[model samples]
Target: MSNRKIKTFAPKGTRDFLPVQMFTRNKIINLIKKIFEKYGYEPLETPSIERLDVLTGKYGEEGDQLIFKILKRGTGLDKVGVELKEFTVTDYKDIIDLGLKYDLTVPLCRVIAMHKDKITFPFKRYQIQPVWRADKPQKGRYREFYQCDVDVAGSSSMLADFEIIYMVYEILKTLGFKNFLIRINNRKILNAILEHCKIEQNKSFFVLSAIDKLDKIGKKGVINELKKKNINEKVIDNLLEIILLEGTFEQKLNELGHIFKENKIGNEGIEELKEIFYYLSKTDIDSDFYSLDLSLSRGLEYYTGPIYESVVKEPKIGSLTGGGRYDKLIGMFLGEDVPATGTSLGIERIIDVMTELNMIPETKTITKVLITTFDENLKQESINTTWKIRNSGINAELFFEPLRLNKQLSYANKKGIPFVCIIGPDEKKQNKVKVKNMKTGEEKLIENNKIVEFIKSITD
Candidate 1:
């Protein structure tokens, strides 16, 4: 006997979306796509695999650790540098040249830089695709997930940031999420606070990442975490105070301006945010839609300017969306700064939140009507009726099985095919069909000449 245990299971942190789940996912994606298109953001797609260098050193230390690095396929390497990432990949040039893209933004940035000459300035684009991460999967988090990103590049104007901010607000509202808040901060401001706190330059991302966890772990917990990283008590204490800096958005910006007045870059950050608010003031956006947040670090080192994170009012699913301005990321390829701002919705997290809230919409059946024949004698009549319905652009399904009447009705019920058009000897003799509403249990006779109209009146 063969001694092998064949296992049939999907990998951890990955999901196999059945029909129902796919319907929900597709509905959410389509809704996002419609909104994106309505905003005049053109769609762009890039290869799923990217060069190793394209991804590394962009997301910061902890973020880099979560990247799913592709391995060298060969058995042995000759003197390869064994640099450890989230996964171990030999730092050999030819060995590990390609890796699955970690996020849509990085690849999009590369596309913009490489094609700058051919592309128009102030370019806007949208991408809806999956990304891979090598992190522990939990609720609202996954190893493989989709990021619906929209970005505008080649402009540093505060208006660009405002457009992205307004876009985020509009997307949530369009998706029927009424209770949410957009948290805004500037990396420059966060950097200023870190500088004021005397956090070492090398460990800046560490501080940002730790503070980003404030929502998950409270203020005291953040301080405890920083202490574990050897951050001084005074530094941690000062950082916490700045994080809790209070008042209205303007008031908070004012306070930061006062504190960082002497600090050139810090004040510049504050001024930029103030101007963003100025531009936003002209819009009819809800006052509570966005607010200035001092502690929002966004946890990504690539963000050199304004940053944003959105949270739902309930269910506590962390950061439904995030994005920021990255002036240096595109420069990594172009060798010159290119101002870019964008935001990405975490599709998996959004789906999870909606599911928890029972907000996943009921799916509509594509096959609007199922045509069943009473017997082989009436099969041809059912077939002709099906084609007539199809010709009128109404979806209809004809059952070929010569099953009993109850079995045919049960099949329609199981498939959720809302309407069943039954063709029997009696109806055929009358040159008519019986349309049964599977949902309402109402049956009506429609003359064959008017069957298409009858179906449209109900199905359309």
Candidate 2:
């Protein structure tokens, strides 16, 4: 035998979803889509691969390096002075200009740019698709994962922002996710504060990334890390003072007005937030789910305005959702500013939290009845009964093994088949069948003609 090890496992950072797991995942996706449509969003799809130039430089510096690139095909690259073996192409843009899309937002923007003439303004779209990233995987984070996104473009109204916020609250509630809080912050407000505080441009990103970890690393840890970055105590204290600044939504805006009185952009951010809250006040929603968290930094380079993140109340799972408003993302392609806001629900992360909390409902076994043939002589009769039961909407499968009656029942029990029907020489002779509730350990004899209804009754 060869000395090579067996290749029996999936690549790291990816997964294979079995039938039961796929069922659960599809159910969740369907629920989300139903809610999204009810909110007047249209379904849209984009190609899984796009020009690397389209995705690169979109998600910040850290995100750019994590992109998975595709290599140039054919042997002709050697003729073009390309060393295929010694130096392989890694940057997708340099090799073929196409790569697997890292997120839906960039492709969505590209679509809007190319199809502007075919679509209407104030376009509302929802995309549910998988994105690829070449990052080291961890619990609740994967290399290949799905993001459920809903976005509205071509409008800058705070009403649209409020509606999206309300949409999130309703969708989570419909999905039975009660232990989440919606954290909101304005990037413009953040930029204003940073500019006013005289924080260097390069230092601002490091500080924002560090502050974003407050939930995971805690305040003290964040402060210590900030100190390690050579940030003086006075700058850290001043930044904290602005973040800790709190009052009623309106009162906070007013206080913010005083702090940013000399800065026009800062005041604009506060005004936009006030309009959002004003519209939010008109809706009857659980106020506890929404909060103005100053520390929230969505980390996307494109987010130029407001930002949002969703975290579970349990404090174990990190934020399961995040998005923000970006003013110039479309401008990169369309040559004009198009204000848009959107959010992406990290499907796997939410599933992890639900599973850990025992919030996902126990899967009800779909196979309701198993038909067993005790004797080969009666196998045809049992097959006929199984078909009749299945025709009547009762899922019944005929046992494959020619084993004893008790063994057949034991196999059905192990498969979680809730009901079992047995037909042997004795029962077939009497034109009857024995139906057993595998769960309850109860049995009853029924006429062969009534087997379908009997199975249906037990299932219902």
Candidate 3:
């Protein structure tokens, strides 16, 4: 054999979850899925790959660059004397036609566009899936991760927006997050600010991109970035003054009402916020859990109306969830526009935070009981007992070999199995099995037909 070493690690920015980790992840996902279903959203799943054109221009410039593109297959350049490393950036279009989806929303839009005829209007759906990005791996950031998204399409009412926010509130509370904030803003208000500053239409995205980084880069960094783009200094001052404006949700809205009195879109955005807050006040949601923050500009280009992000006050990790209304995204696929609103729960980050906070329960293994083979003669008895317990929905594993009883018990202890069932020749003849409580060292003789009940009594 060659002496070269084979790489055994997973690629960067991805992970291989062990059973212990998967148990917690599944628990969290199931909880989130339950909450989504409770809100009248149905489940939907789309393919992992999509046509390149379908995903290209939807996210902003920085987001577009993070997409993981997939090259075409079976285009035999080798037979034609071309090598794989010889291709240049200009040749990508000819060799690449597909890419991994950047997020769940784009593919959903494509689906609605293609199936609008058969589907009902105002379709509410939830999707829990993995999305790929070609980004530098960092703490709590991965190139491949799961996004749990719930969305409502074909509705223009701000009620849909409120539902999305309320569902976020409910989910975080359900997940045992006590100190978190749901920061809400409207793109129309940001657009009006840009207009008030006389920021050119072409450079609007650049200005927003800089503003989005205010949390990461700080005010001075944002100012420097804007200055680099030749934005007038006085205009930058005026823009920051409004963006950094602080007060209660109502107070800030009232202040902006005077600032943008003549600006139709700005006034419309402010009115939308007032209506959402009015709806929120009628509910039991705590006012401290949600707020209106003008600086909360989501990086995606598709968000056209109210946008919100959920963040934990403690660990200082980034957003746990993000999304907003995209009234025009579906229109890209269909001939006409359909109003859509949604939010995506960043499950990976949430799990990381839970782990840090010691919130995830200890779950070493799923096997509840181990059925040990006493010997070759009694192996059949153990096998039958294992199946009997399994039939009753108890997670039971049969020892593969008729090893010594102590060795089988050792295996159960190592795997953290709570109970062990022993059926030796004597017990088999007596029509009974010995069940040992691995945690307590207590042993009992359970009747053959009572095995399932005995296991459930303690485990459940």
Specify the highest-TM-score model's number: 3
TM-score of each: 0.91, 0.89, 0.95
**Model 2 agreement with the true structure over 85-158: per-residue lDDT tens digits:** 67555554455666898998988899899999998989899999999999998888789999989999999987
Q: Rate the local accuracy (lDDT) of all candidates.
A: 0.86, 0.84, 0.91
Question: Which is the leading candidate under lDDT?
Answer: 3
As for model 2, its CA RMSD to the true structure in angstroms is 3.4
By TM-score rank, best first, the candidates go: 3, 1, 2
Off-target runs (Cα >4 Å) in candidate 1 are 1-6, 71-90
**Total colliding residue pairs, candidate 3:** 0
Which residue pairs show collisions in model 2? Answer: none
Model 3 earns a TM-score of 0.95
Q: Write the per-residue lDDT of candidate 1 for residues 1-460, one digit (tens) a residue.
A: 8888798787889999988788888888988888889888999999888888898888877777787767556624433786534554445455666678899999998998889888998889999988999889988888999999999999999888888888888878877888899999999998899888888898887788888888778887898889889999987888888888889888888888877879988998998899888877779887788888887887677888999979996897788999999988888888898899999999898888888888876775568999897887778888899999899998788888979989999998998999999888888889888999998999999999999988999986
* Model 1 steric clash total: 0
For candidate 1, the lDDT comes to 0.86
Q: Is candidate 2 or candidate 3 better by lDDT?
A: 3
